[model samples]
Target: MKVLIIGLGSIAKKHIAAINKLDQSAEIYALRSNPHSKSDIAGVIDTYNLNDVKVSELDFVLISNPTSEHFSTLQQLVEFDIPLFIEKPLFSKINEETQSLVDEFEKKEITTYVACNLRFLDCIKELKTILKDAKINEVSVYCGSYLPNWRPGVDFRTVYSANKEMGGGVHIDLIHELDYVYWLFGNPDKTNSFFSNTSSLKISAYDYANYLWTYKTFSASIVLNYFRKESKRSIEVVTDKGTYYVDLLKNTIEFNNKCIFASQKRIADTYYNQIEFFVKNILIGREKFNTIKEANTILKLCMKD
Candidate 1:
């Protein structure tokens, strides 16, 4: 399959790797601003301009550019009718124009899948299964990591995560928590959130955010930040049966102080699985997870005040 990737950033690299692992014969083409800095990664053919690409022969397009550029990129590709594999959060912010584009996608019947690889994690999948029949009472999700440590040798202040316009805030950048929360529990009856640059990090984007979602019988709270000295990504769910602790970093799920599920796989595995699923669905002309409409709903929840 001929695949066109719009960006060549870290996440884009991961997607390339996943695609390579999934289908070695897949011809990977990239449209990059600085195509001169062409990728050394095997199986990738870099193009200096979109005009150089044969869009008609492309099987799908992966929008892995900055969140701020997603809309413009989509605007250019909207008429192509190619399936899309968009990176998470959909956009840095959503507005009526974004909604109009979403409507166009629906009107055109585009097969678009927004990335939410966390949903493919074994631990998360197992937790979803366990809570399927349980009466949920409360859920607390915490995800934090030192921003500077995210990309060694790179200034955290210079990265997209540090800029609000580029969609670098903890709430938007770390939206997997919100995505999976919605995946597990569906939409909340009411939602409230507080997010701001409450850290010493030299960034314009909000480094910390807390969200509360209320359901009919249960409530969920999520805390996200980019300034924890020690990395942590876990979820605690209280149900009628018992509380279950999920350690996303450790890839383990525990209940009643006993371990229940452990995948022991690197987080990249989930990315691979997600891409595999996306490619498979594209081949079958259907997407079962994180469609643009579904992701837009979660994006609205994130942006909800």
Candidate 2:
């Protein structure tokens, strides 16, 4: 399966690296929209023409480009009819314009998948399975980091995370929490979200986002921040009888049952795990990853104010 990756940005490089690790048989090709786009991938020859991105030659495509143009780009791919694996926060922001296009994709029954990398993530995956049928008393996740520290080489001022037009904010940066909340528990009738760039920092986008979901059976709260000394990604699911914690950095799962216990060292790469799932669905007609429609719903929910 030949794979074509568009938008050779920071995330695209990681996706390329993971793809190389997952499957060697699949050929990798890279593309950037502008001839002047500064790409990080070494030894890669980039061409600007979209026609050069032959949808027929490639079996799959990863649309990792900045979201301001995702709608038009996606519409072009819809015409091509090849399956797409889009990254998180499907659009710049949810609105009537994007909703109508999403609805049309559903009606045509196109084969599409969205990248909620954490869904197939090893640490998160184990925790989801262990707590699938269990009771949840509380769910809280902490996702934060010093923006400048994200890429040790690049200056934070130049990154997309600090730009609003590129959909770089706590809402999109830390939206995994929102997606996983709905993944673990069903959709909530309502979600209240408040966001701000608390420090009045140099950045124009939000630095902190706090979301609260009040459900009939249980309540959930998530705090996402991009201003901090240390980088942390952790989730704690508290139940009636016990609690579970996933230390993403450590890639370990530990459950505190007092007398009983459960834990595992994660072996799968989250990126590859999700990519493998998507590839399997394409190759074998299996429902490995979340559908495009399901991902769109998650996208819409995260856009709620």
Candidate 3:
């Protein structure tokens, strides 16, 4: 298969690696803005101009560019009628223009899938199954990690995650919790949020974000931050039966202090599985794997004040 990737950043590299693992013979092409930027990964052809890409000959296009450029990039490629695999947090901000673009995709029946690989995590999948028919009461989600330690040997201030203009805030950056919350429980009747730069992290983006979503029978709270000495990502859910704790960083699930499920899987496994699923979905002509509309709904919730 011939795949075109628009950006050669870290996330793009993960996708490339995942795709390669699934199909050893897949031809990979990258469209980068910086002509000087090159890929160290073997078999990746780098093209500086979009005109050099033959959309008709490609199996699909993956948008792994900065969040700020996703809208324009999608606009440029949407008319080509090629399937799209966009990285998470579909847009930095949603507006009429963005909505119109979404409408255009729907009108054209474009096959699109927005990446939210966390949904494919082994522990998360098990949690979904356990809560499939349980009576949920309340949920608490916390995700915190130090920004300076995110990428070793790289300046934290230089990345897009540190700039608000590039969509680097904790609210949008750690949107996986919100996506899975919606996936497991559907939309909330109301949402309240607070996003601000509460940390000394030398970045222009908000380093902290908190959200409360209210449903008919339950409520969920999500807290995200970029300045914590020790990294943590976990979820605690209260149900009629008991409370459940999920440690994403540890890949384990527990109920009332008793371990229920544990997986020795690395986080990279989710990325690989996600790409594998997307490839199979495309091959079988399935278009319902995390559609743009579904991602947009989560994006809208993130923007709520």
Ranking by lDDT: 3, 1, 2
lDDT tens string, model 3, 146-234? 98999999999988889998788888998898998988888999999998895788679989999999999989999999999799999
Q: Give the poorly placed runs of model 2, Cα more than 4 Å off.
A: 36-45, 257-268, 286-288
lDDT of each: 0.89, 0.75, 0.90
Q: What are the TM-scores, per candidate, against the unseen true structure?
A: 0.97, 0.89, 0.97
Clashing pairs in 2: none
TM-score of 1: 0.97
Worst lDDT run of 10 residues, candidate 2, spans 258-267
The number of the candidate with the highest lDDT is 3
For model 3, the stretches where C-alpha displacement exceeds 4 angstroms are: none
